[model samples]
Target: MVDHVYDPPERCVAGSVGPPGQRTFFVQATDGARRTTVSLEKEQVRLLGTSLVQLIDEVAPREGSEEAAAAYLDNAPLDAPFDDDFRVQRLSIAWQPERERVVIEAYDRPDIEDLMGLDPEGDYPWDGLPPQSLAIVLDAPRARAFASRCTASLEGGRPGCPFCGQPLDPSGHICPRANGYRR
Candidate 1:
């Protein structure tokens, strides 16, 4: 499988398409004129952003990190021509102490049907081949900015149910905490 590596991409951000409750999330990485976008679940984006922040704090905690994140924040929307190259199935993140860079890898599984028969170990049975992946490496500031932007994008979604914390749809949701009553 091809690994599209963007070491220090010109721009990398997590964004969503469509309205709040019905949004589709994606991670886009751009290097010069080349761009790659991968579709993923909302929870995946949230977890990645949260994990990145935690990892940075653990590896390079400093007061200036927040200031630098704000200074380099990318509030702009995802780059246009928003086409998804693949659907991400798994994600991995790491902090490289030697380079002081954060690396994020997103593995793609084109379709759910492709994994209809998986082994007990959750390994695919496809000729021992690995999934296509997209990797992005970012400096401390850029990494923080990416996490901040991810948080902002997530908050832009539909408000959560006050009782259950689940997303409240336009017609309201039957919050379990509210005893199945629509709220």
Candidate 2:
């Protein structure tokens, strides 16, 4: 139940530091003074970015607020020594009218105790570290820009196989859409 909240974070984006075929996905949020970067599934990044844009467009209370959002948060290189709170297992999005921003919550997967229904250790707390979550808030324009950046990041990776729309590594691709033929 512990959450790291970044209200109107200075920056929030989905980016990768490795090559396309061997890249690791990440979602990073910073508040100028503090920065938090977390690992996430590539699909998760894609969905979050796209969903934020859609939600803001559909539900923002103010008219033309989407266009007024300031995409000022620049994606600097992720700080080194990625911490424990960096891995994200679940992501949720919502519009906060009071803040005039879209809030994105990234949560860790359920712990063994929660999944197994019993804590054999008898000392493990369900609200332990690995199960924590990070929440970031961004305005409509920033959310839109973030979605575009995330989508661009995904596209920057390996080229997709024309046959199946699956990513193609630099060396080659075995496209199942082509019936297991290398495309």
Candidate 3:
């Protein structure tokens, strides 16, 4: 497995492209010379942001954390002219107490059918090809900033239906609460 480790990336953030209801989400990590970008589901971005904020609050509760986050807030769009290294299969985050950092890992996906068809007693799955991954570590303040950007990006998307909580497309969606009515 190739692990692109950015021990303390110069910048890391979540961003999206395209319009709401058809947007493609991505997470990017960059040092100076190398930048790694990976595409992921919108839900993954949401959960990561939520988890980052929750984890930071749990470990580094301090006055002015929000204010401190502003200092590191990166509202800049993702670096352009870049191709995604891979599509994220799984995302995991954790706190590093000793170093006082948050570690985020995005694992590249393997074929679902191959994974499901694995033979426990046969040769290991993935055969000769190992998936690549991206790992990023950030300080608490930067993590908070990253989380804020995530929340902002999500809120800019399509408005949610009051009754069903599903995103309302540009043409409206069939809300379950509305009994099949497109609203």
Best by TM-score: 3
Task: Give, for candidate 3, the lowest lDDT window spanning 10 residues.
Answer: 120-129
Instruction: Give per-candidate clash totals.
Output: 0, 2, 0
Clashes of 3: 0
Model 2 misplaced stretches (Cα beyond 4 Å) = 61-67, 70-76, 80-84, 110-130
lDDT of 3: 0.84
Most accurate candidate by lDDT: 1
- Per-model TM-score on C-alpha atoms: 0.85, 0.78, 0.86
Give the higher-lDDT candidate: 1 or 2: 1
| 2 against 3, candidate with superior lDDT | 3
Better of 1 and 2 by TM-score: 1
Candidate 2 local lDDT, residue 42: 82
Give the candidate order by descending TM-score. 3, 1, 2
Worst 10 residues of 2 by lDDT: 63-72
